[model samples]
Target chain A: MAGHSAGTEIERLIQLLSRLPGLGPRSARRAALQLLGKKETLMRPLADALQDAADHVLTCTTCGNLDTTDPCSICADGRRDKGVICVVEQVADLWALERAGANSGQYHVLGGTLSALDGVGPDDLNISGLVTRVSGSDVREVVLALNATVDGQATAHYITDQLEGSGANVSQVAHGVPVGGELDYLDDGTLAAAMKARRPF
Target chain B: MAGHSAGTEIERLIQLLSRLPGLGPRSARRAALQLLGKKETLMRPLADALQDAADHVLTCTTCGNLDTTDPCSICADGRRDKGVICVVEQVADLWALERAGANSGQYHVLGGTLSALDGVGPDDLNISGLVTRVSGSDVREVVLALNATVDGQATAHYITDQLEGSGANVSQVAHGVPVGGELDYLDDGTLAAAMKARRPF
Candidate 1:
């Protein structure tokens, strides 16, 4: 049906584009048409780029960050604090922390969190790999920078429990009202926590 | 900065995905991550699909519809009303009309409508090709199924002016409250048009 007016090739392209995160059927069709319109400037280059990424991109063997290298540029960089490992639920969270300039330490991507309701558990995550990395490295601290969500916190707790007496200090990121966030917009729990940890500012 | 963690290849891929019609930078990154997660099942196939589309999709020489062939399926189909050419601004429009079963005629895609502010003119569109198609063919009617937008009306007027002496009758699609649309929710213009063109049920 999709190929009735446009070709089968365009239909297939739209199908693939719809599989992408933000695009639906209409947007995918629009995108396909746009690409066809700008084939020389966009469509051919997009195909080449996707092929390049599929062929070259690899997950870091040490931290699980997606990159072009085995260990990744982050893991390969000796300047980072390798003795401190920052644990994150996903590569996006790790990137968020890195973007905020909050941590100069290496990261461990958990891929996902512990969610009992969703049938996810310790074995479902990268917890065993985290333990392996800690047991093999001279890490001074294992920082859990997971999300504030229940699953993220539960995963952090589970990781912390696993690393008990592993000859390294285990810690997690703080919880407080976000910077530039209005107090009225803050939830009761956040307000309570912010009050409990009130600063001199 | 995008290459800081995900590598230059991924950064470049995100850059191209963001160039798509509906995807922004953040969504593009998410899409890239999703593609990477399913490289074998999705990413590789998507790359091949895009390549195939870019390589094979061509505009129909007869109707300007995009297809795998020069004349396109609609133009070549012996069952369709080839004597009645339905003119639309884009292939999407052609498909929309086809989806609604509104027309079973050959199509002419203008690619885009005339917009003086946007620097688009009659010469910039497929007007001359349309003239040639009508002049050299047995076409009896030209249905302007263009959108009711300002530019769409302007373009329709231009095409009508050019086809003045042509034997083929020119007709714009009727305007009214859309089928299954409530009268209260309809725009004033649509209500008036519907009232003026009212018929016994």
Candidate 2:
């Protein structure tokens, strides 16, 4: 495998594919083989798609969403509720929320959380843009849909502090036992949060 | 996600990535986000590598191995023992054997096994080319390093029959307990095979 018996081009393809988030070396090799086996059907189209994305996909100036347009489809759409903006850590989280259909409002991507260990500060993220979007606008509610991680909470708190008197009500997505999640398999923190947040049903 | 919130190019990239062997829709989205995040470093290089592979990689005429050249580096090399030909089902198997340093001899890729149910026949494989290479040559042995599956063995038997009286000894890789296999977790058929093929050590 090191000597690349399949040739340099195939080896390079496998190496690049292995760098993807979920693909390992073995699966990358298999993927390369499949691509080579069906060049016209899979490989060519995939190459074209990658090229197209690289050339066209851009970050939205308003929401920080990745799209072919500057404002993105979500920002450009008139049907979405502009008054309530769901703030997420990344475009992936926004896509997840959209897929789940949990929000009918607009979205604001922060790019990433404030990570001190990695030397990632507020300036490294799109926090300033979010504050600017929230201030002097029709946006009445800003929902923090960030992850439950420490950095995510810290970033949310920082954003909340930044939007203190912007005349927009700040809120956070509920943190409790996930729907359909087994309590036996849940962590102590989640169990405590679920207990504390219990409502009168 | 269905409406291509990230735009058509990003959605197309994710769709193509999901079609790969090991990636599903969720992982594809993650991979696409990673690519978008690192457009210059990862996405562009991957696109270039894939395009290069699609344009240059050709099927080796001698052994059916994928390579940039016709005869392939293996066939072109003068140091390899041409007298012993290791036959495998596909280029992947040939690569596996090469990676393990299992064979110093030449190779013959059969493309695929003889699958009657799938309507694959002898003519569909590169069996005739292997026979032609073995006949009227100084070849001493033809090793069938095919899978231990039913179709693989059937193809091996058919090849053994076809290569009869061709001045070459036909053999198959042994099937038994793997080198690092545990006895307790061994299957009945494997344990039986190991017992039947016991050596006087």
User: In lDDT terms, which candidate is top?
Assistant: 2
Candidate lDDT scores, in order, read 0.88, 0.91
DockQ each: 0.75, 0.75
| Model 1 per-residue lDDT tens digits across residues B40-107 | 99999998988898889998988888888987888899999989999999888887887778888888
Model 1, span A137-172: residue lDDT tens? 799999999888888888888898999878889988
* Model 1 spans with C-alpha error above 4 angstroms: A1-3, B1-3
Clashes of each: 0, 0
TM-score of 2: 0.96
TM-score of chain A of 1: 0.94
What DockQ would you assign to candidate 2? Answer: 0.75
Interface RMSD of each: 1.2, 1.3
Span of 10 residues, lowest total lDDT, candidate 2 chain B: B1-10
